[model samples]
Target: MKSGTVSQDYDKNETDGKVGLKRRLGFFDSLSFLVGTIIGAGIFVSPKGVLEYSQLNIGVALCIWAACGVICILCTLCYAELGSSLPFAGGEYYHVRRGLGPIPAFITIWTLTLFIRPSSNAARALTFAEYVSRPFYSGCPPPELLKKSLAIGILLTLGVINSKSIKLATWVQNIFTILKMMALTLIIVYGFIEFATNPDASKPFQDAFNSQFPNAAQTAEAFFQGLYAYGGWNFLNYMAEEIKNPSKNIPRSVITAMCAVIVFYLLVNISYLTVLTPRELISSAAVSVTWADRMIPSWAWIIPVSVAISIFGSLNGGMFMLGRLNYAGSKEGHLPSLISMLHVRHLTPAPAMIISTLIACIFVIPSDLVSLTNYFSFSSWLLVGLTCVSLIVLRFREPNLERPYKVFLPLAFVVVGVSAFLVLAPIIQSPKVQYFYALLFMFSSIIIYIPFVHFKLKIPYFNKITCYLQLLLEVSPTDMFEDSKTE
Candidate 1:
């Protein structure tokens, strides 16, 4: 594999021919980054929402979650291959740029920096604030300002961690990831033990495939909700440039982390159901904590503390990844290079980190706790569908590019992606929350993109075909006219 190559312009500027590679992140460090990005408050809160839709058939709910996970794994593999071959810092922004075109790619990065990443960070921080205050507030809660203040604090703290040092930030991430996993394992083991000791205590599992199954429309919405719980399976794609060996390590980390999360999610969901009846889980908002309380005495706080830690890690993870995306954009001259400024002493993207944290703080202010999470989930899935389509399009246009981790069944990947896209129609038709958010943020992004290109940056071929294709796949075609033109 080619170890390093500088941009042609950079090489031209150098007096002597010399290209430098960024510092390497080991396999375990990459895995830790993935784990930290995922395993957040969504797992704790989203399950209750899924149970609300999938009531009485716990096994079926678990199965649906597992199915969503499988589809995510397929997409993760596709991204892994793209990331490995191209090995850039910006994650989807890089892939989309290489596969789609500059304009669309710019839009993706713009949306991520301005909206999606901020929304994600805000949601996680808000979740942390809610849990942190729960013990004091009990069933009754605090004033709105207090909650927002706490959320902002959470964002700032995580931003500080990210800006300090990548090594320090990732080390903290690895520790939290391990702790969160252990906490989950404890939940699983304790629940199973309770089930074994008192079989009569558990409720019967639900059968999702029964004839009395909810109508296709209702089932589709439930599946969509289930999909949110498995949303962060692509976290590894964002940190491709940081990995020690992009060609091989990036692919392995993405696939391995996704697969592991899927299994962990499945097992945890099953354990949750085994301990609590579907009816109980559906009704209880804090189902996981309640389950923990029942399994062990004086341990209700354990679940809350653990979940808070997990969410904290997730908040930092999103900021870290999004910081890189913005940093990469600045480096490429697509965005103000000032945003790309690294702390000369620390070598971290402090400006982007602070900016991301600030936006996140803003998002958390107007929104209540629950809407923030749902909004992030809604926007995340819609964009994920867009990104997946970009993947398939890039393949046909750039067939010969090296792929370190290709999706095993290309047609199956396409089918799964298409099915995911189709499912969104029903989800939006039933309740138009995510659709509204998707349109609002995306249109706003386009508005910003037009000016950023026309005025701020003299971007070359902003609407070129190669740029659009790169938006889907990470690799741009060497020859522009190789593929038949669509437009």
Candidate 2:
């Protein structure tokens, strides 16, 4: 592995006498982060899309949800092996670098950090703002400015907390995860109540299997909804270096979290259907809100408050991972070297976190987030599919790479096949101009990477600039390799 943009990731950086990021996350904290990241606004809103796409066939929709969870676990196991063996901050980027090559790796982190991640963070923040501000504007929608401001404020607030202490960030994640889980428990419990007291209301299940199955296209769309909701299944891998006992906990936590999310998702959707029939579920703009309205109109406020809190925890978890991605990229010299530095005393990537939050804030101001999120969505999945492919490549290429948890090669292959379908299905079914643009945008990173990063484009007096940022941010820099430049 000769030095290239991120090829150095395959080997360790010789110690530079500087303190690195402390491993602060235990299994509990790691599980909390994964669960919180996965159960975002998706479960609350996406059930409707799944049901609608599956043509109100409750049985098929449930299967799609379960299928998506299984697919995610398979894909995540492949990452578990990488997280344990490679154990770096960048997650997929590091795995791709070692197994595939530096260019693909650089392209992944670059496109994600620059576009996909920030846009995602922005979407989460905006949703959080809307939920929180809705009460105040019950007469009409809240002013766009109010929502954007609240969105930016929350993003920055989380950034500051992450900057100060990893402990604090994980603590916030844990509390939020618990709170959201409790909310989901309430939903599941009520669904049980609905079944016990009023069997007629649970019509979706009464003759669930009798409804005609959705066509192939509709089934794929339903699965896509599930996949979208399950987006952050791999988030824990990115912070492998920060987790305690990476080998055991990486696989254990990811598996545990996904299982819990699947149960919660399945039960919650079942709960929703118990109260609202297929027509009500599909017709409603928001599934949870409608469920709450019918189930307990007087206590309907609870769901909105819970959703706001859920999004809060999710945003915190996402920002933590987003910051880590930036730090990881910088560590590999794919991003500005300044971002790689850890806080002097706290050993946190405050600069990277803040920069990421700022970019997300910029994205929050946009009025049309759906268009923004859609444009970059396919590329995100494409990279994910490629990362899974890297797992297969590494198994043969580096059989001796000391895997703490080796995934079954066949399961890895299955995930790769599924990933290929997911990455291609939308384009092949109903091609969109944005999909083409996204492909161009994703690969364009290669053109920029070749000269600027791969060649280590030297910046005159960059050392002075790095020193200034280090002093201002109180961060310690990693030792750079001979071929590496400031950025």
Candidate 3:
């Protein structure tokens, strides 16, 4: 059962013109992808939720933030081992398929494709639109149609960029990531200066831990909010197949990205506290924006503009990986073969990109930012936790398999434990009807899988449809190569 003994025919398929993902991404590209994807609108917006749940206790809120960072880093390490060992597309789906079985793998990608990813993309897109429109608003909230249109417009722009060239997409990601970091640096630097000059600025920290204590449920919910901000740390693994020297790069990128974010998050929270009291943070809808407005009213415009840029970068990263997910699923014969096709001229998965874009656009209509975050966090973490469990199973089942990066067994257990807590805590605290609806949506994938994949039941004209799609989509032949057994 171990990957070393499994006799990977996948390599042969790659060499036999059966796989088409190009290996053009390097370490920095992946690093930028991770940072840009993780540092999106969550940090700007979720502080309110985190502060509220922590009962306005600055010390407790900071602890929850640090705890979430630890959990995210641990999970990243687990993914590092898998990504380096497998170095494939599809990320969690591939890991689960290899360690657990195809059924779980199918379900993982099914939920991600149909719900999790699209919903997430829509949320980021909407956040981008909201921030972009903020400066233009006179006194009333922007029109709903205006927001939706802007969201769709940005989605289309990113989709086009991604469809044309991955290089172009990564370039966009890198530039925006650097810009975002600069913006954040400005906030942190200015906040520190203000704290140094203003004698009473440390008042908030004086009694940081003395505020009203939250119940266990509230603490868990606060941690969940922090986790939402830290969600995209694992995105680099989704394109592992495209990363150059993946065995080395995957672990390095994960470590670098996680460490950078953890430091930035801790500092950002400190910066927020310096300018605003715990109660102020709880009441503010946009913590970062409020900080900017207070710190420099003349330059207040920069906050919303930078937030829009931050979200644009996230949307770009999301679309870039989503297409790869569809391509991975198609390669496994779990989805229509058309999705696996690479554009002949551009060397991108055009059809998959379009499909992902269209689905995300549809999602924009039904959900708001907060609900989308909750829905995605609950369901996606359930699978993420399962994927981490797969690492443990594979360690025992495939002990001989080569892993360039190996997470310690104890740490892996902690990851699984934390993931379980995150998945269950919200439901236990206050079960919403949406949780059941999300569950129903996930389980419904089983019906489609059994009839199509498990039983291999052919629907009418399926082959012809795939053939026509192949032609229309300009799918290149699959690439095949011998699987390297050793690094």
Regions of model 3 farther than 4 Å from truth? 1-19, 368-373, 480-487
The residue-by-residue lDDT of candidate 1 on 276-341, one tens digit each, is: 766777777777787877677576788889999898877777888888888767655567545565
- Which digits, one per residue and each the tens of the lDDT, describe model 3 over residues 1-487? 2455222433343345454676788889999999999999887666778889999888899998998998889999999999888887889987888778878888899889987898889988887888888668967788878898999999999999999889899999999999999988988899899889999998888888999988988888788788889988888888988887788889999999999998998888899889988778888888987898799999988888888889999889999999989888877778876787888777788888999999999988866533645655677778888998899998998788877788888888888887787788778777888888778878888999898887879889988987888787776745533432211
How many angstroms is residue 355 displaced in model 1 relative to the true structure, after the best TM-score fit?
1.1
Better of 1 and 3 by TM-score: 3
Cα lDDT for residue 58, candidate 1: 57
TM-score of each: 0.84, 0.94, 0.94
Best by lDDT: 3
lDDT: the better of candidates 1 and 3: 3
Candidate 2: which stretches are off by over 4 Å?
Answer: 1-18, 479-487
Candidate 3 lDDT at 93 equals: 84
